[model samples]
Target chain A: MSLKKTRFKYLGESLIEGNIKITAILAIIAVFLIFFFILRESLPIFFNGEVQQEITFGKFFQGIQWQPVSDHPRFSLWPIIMGSLKVTMIALVFAVPVAIGAALYSSEFAGRRLKEFIKPVVELLAGIPSVVLGFFALIIMASFLKNIFGWTYRLNAVNAGIALGFAIIPAIYSLAEDALNAVPKSFREAALGLGATPWQTAVKVVLPAALPGVSAAVLFGMGRAVGETMVVLMAAGNAPLFSLNPLESTRTMTATIAAELGEVVFGSGHYHALFFIGLTLFTVTFVINLISWALFDGLMSKLYGAKK
Target chain B: MNSKGHLRKIKDRIKIGLTGSAVLLILAILAVILGTVIIGGYKSISWEFLTQPPKEGMTKGGIFPAIFGMVFSLLMMLIAVVPVGVATAVYLHEYARPDFILTKLIRGAVNNLAGVPSIVFGLFGLGFFIQFIGGSLDRSLGQSGLFGQPCILWASLTLALMNLPMIIVATEEALRAVPQAERAGALALGATKWQTIQNVVLPQAIPGILTGVVLVVSRGAGEVAPIMFTGAAYYLPYLPKLPTDQFMTLGYHIFVMTTQSPDIDATMPIAMGATLVLLALTFSLNIIAIIIRSRTRSQLRKGR
Candidate 1:
């Protein structure tokens, strides 16, 4: 009856427990295997003389050009890195306000019926596949945007980034809404008891109190934008440009790997190079995820006092 | 009550208006996207489009091959992920102490797994599954081509890995909803821990587990990156006859059609149709999962 942790006293307990324990640990094993294998595959680019003779670590960060196939192939990552940064910046700029505003409305202003309606709508948005969003951006949004903006290129960072915004809004909105909701009732009551309006209570009191979680939402949104592949692949004109222009065609790290990996020669420099890009992406997203998780955990502990 | 009060009230109303508009703007975006897709998708969708394979450089015919491959890979992925995901959830809920180090690590890994990019999973599939494990199998079995290549099995495994976290989280929430009284009653009847879990806990969790299964299938069906290099192909003359055979999938079909198709004008409709099919698939499955989850939640509430 006291179930802190079940102590099953039976003859075959060890067998059942042991079997379940192995499966239980598979998540950790999967994570380790992913990191290890990605790192393993990417190592050739650094130490393997064959790959190094073609591209060096110094040149990888320094070179402006990113042509992987040419008479003189260069493996510099600056342009694509710039592209990744540009697309991510545009996505964050577009998604953060819309997501935060939506979160605030759902958590603060909406009544029960409206909350229910908003919830499903967001879920439906979340449910849409990335490939479908990419298609929308490519076939529909791209042209629509062209008519408005009149860009030289049909597909550019803005088209992909805004589409990417839709892809990530669900995540940021949910987390931010949860954070805003988690602000204790006492905070709202106290603010209201001081003659503050509902808007003031929400914006000034609840939002500031939930800052950690809200920032975590922003960070998670950033991570999603950074690692998002298919949307950027299909929508972002896959030209690696060094310019900071949002209207230019951009190629991201994730998109580069996806678009190029199909044609790469196994065990070749290009192959390892793709793996290297994968490695960088993995590390960056992993770090971002961990930071956001920590921030979210901090918010949980702060608000709920370790119970949640 | 005073002059400054009027200014504050106006500012409050302004803030409320802005936030409310934000909500509408998001919903409007959602409507536009869905509206456009539905309008365009309806035109491309016909009976043959659902039942037949593409013909004449993919400008005509249906997407039956893509649907078949999507279902095939999803089934494989479910077979691989469910047991492990369910078992992990059980372990987290029933077996381990909440503060145990191993439990903390498992939970951390589960959360982190959710955040790993879809494309990273693709890389791991190539690096670990195809090259490493498959290469090892090929070497050990003295066969070169059989195991060391992109195929449905590897793709499913990659997808299984990608989806393990989601299933585990859902199952854990479901397991959590099974009230303590049920366990207490089972234990009071002299049932052992394993017996209580098997007889009492699992029965109530089935709906929740089914919800997780539906969700996994929906996600696995739409996931294109991990499968792109592992098994999903641009085109296949025939359906995949073996686990090792590459196959067409709806998501990858749309990707290739939009990005790399030779006849963009001709194939745009097919691509739109494929997008609609995938959208219909994931959306319906999501709605089903949502329904199941809500029902389970209500059941849990009532039982409590």
Candidate 2:
């Protein structure tokens, strides 16, 4: 009797549904597949005799460089990890305020025509591919920046970070704009009725209400910047240096995997090492994406739940 | 009280001005990037540049091979991604037994998949496609190295996986726009669940799914890192004619010319031209997608 209630009226319908169910799971499968395959290659470092001969867990911490090539190879991940952090920090510091501000202006102040124009402009910026941005940063921005302020190196974290900042601004702006726009129309009306000006309404009422989403937007941008490869590969002078100076040439985790994985022998220590870097990059971004999605979606339900 | 009110008003003015200036600065950056490429690359984008292959160490000639290769790979990517993406959307929307828990899990996976650093994907492609799966197939079939190598097929499949989330999200949005009442109406008229979806829901979702496809193509065309070791060649003397052949892509071409070129000065102009072409291709596709999406969204609102 229970089976009868769930039965399909047509015979092939259940079959089709089953097929679709199998297909749908491929997305989840693909995600796991990526982790599994990368892990499969990366595990050799910890277990393989040949890889362990040149590399050890302690060497990664003790050594301060990522010189994977030489008579003596060192796989200290400190330099690249720090390099990733420095470049990402500079990029976020440069991008977040401007993106949030533009979002605020668009949501609170701009007229319909200005608002329309601004959205498409940001989309156009988004559509300009990362490689093109990398090209600009390399040939145009590098020299142009050099002429403005004389620097020891033409390509450094500052140059790469700014270029990377350009790549992420659109993403942050879009998310922030959506967050700002999500506040109920009545909230603004109520704020204005209480004698608050438009600026005060935006800053005090709407912004606090949208805070979760706005920060989520910033988090999303941070994730994208951390994972981005070609921009830093082209713009940052690929020097794996352990320094806090934003003016120093740097290499990032993503860039390291991209640049080294190409030339490394197929089944050697270097190849396994590159996969290890890939695993860390994957884990960093997966955690960020998970947290951001929670924040981004939680705000929507909260806003709408409050409306009810 | 009057002076304090004045001070508050002044503070408000300053804050608003700051936000507006932020907008201006972003616009200025975009303008500068576009302006530099256009002004610098204009002389290099002639008919000969578009139709001929690179000559004399890529200082002269056009980007025909890169164009052909990119289109070929994208076509294969479209074939691989669309059905899986559409099925994922349909299963979430129509089936899955009202389990929000399962739905949320799928979405979380999809979103995380999108955010995975692309270089890791390049590594995954190399390890999974070129060595593990491809090697297994070759060994089983008694072949030497036909399948166990970097080729256009692997690169396109890798891109399809990278882009699956975007397609699923877009298709779901389109599915959401179709009113529940319409589905009920179809059911009330003796239509089965499968029949109702096939006859009513899917037809309306085609535009949205197309928007996703176009967006993915535009995106995949510009991506370089995922294809670097998977199948993208630095310089291919011949165009890739089969799934097994390596291909040259515009983004990789720009990357190689910028970094690996022995003669940077001579290669810069050619790279600039390729950048403009890629920019134009992606921008026009983006505009088309925007137009289609807005039109569909308006129709959905009007129907509601």
Query: Which one is best on DockQ?
Result: 1
Candidate 2 runs further than 4 Å off: A1-9, B1-7, B97-100
Off by over 4 Å in 1: A1-9, A306-308, B1-7
For model 2, how does the per-residue alpha-carbon lDDT over A71-186 read when each residue is reduced to its tens digit? 88998999999989999999999999999999999999989889987887888788888899889999999988888998888899999999999999999999999989999999
Q: What's every prediction's RMSD, in angstroms?
A: 2.8, 2.5
lDDT of 2 by residue, B153-238 (tens): 99999999998999999999889888898899999998888889999999988999999998999999999999999899988888
Clash count (model 1, backbone only): 0
lDDT of 1 by residue, A1-308 (tens): 44534443553777898889899998899999999999998887778898787766676876688888788887889999988889888999998998999999999889988987888788888888888889999999999889987888999999999999999999999999999898888898899999889998998999999999999999999999999998999899999888898898989999999988998878878888888898889889989988998999899888997234
Global Cα lDDT for candidate 2: 0.90
Q: For each candidate, how many residue pairs have backbone atoms clashing (under 3 Å)?
A: 0, 0
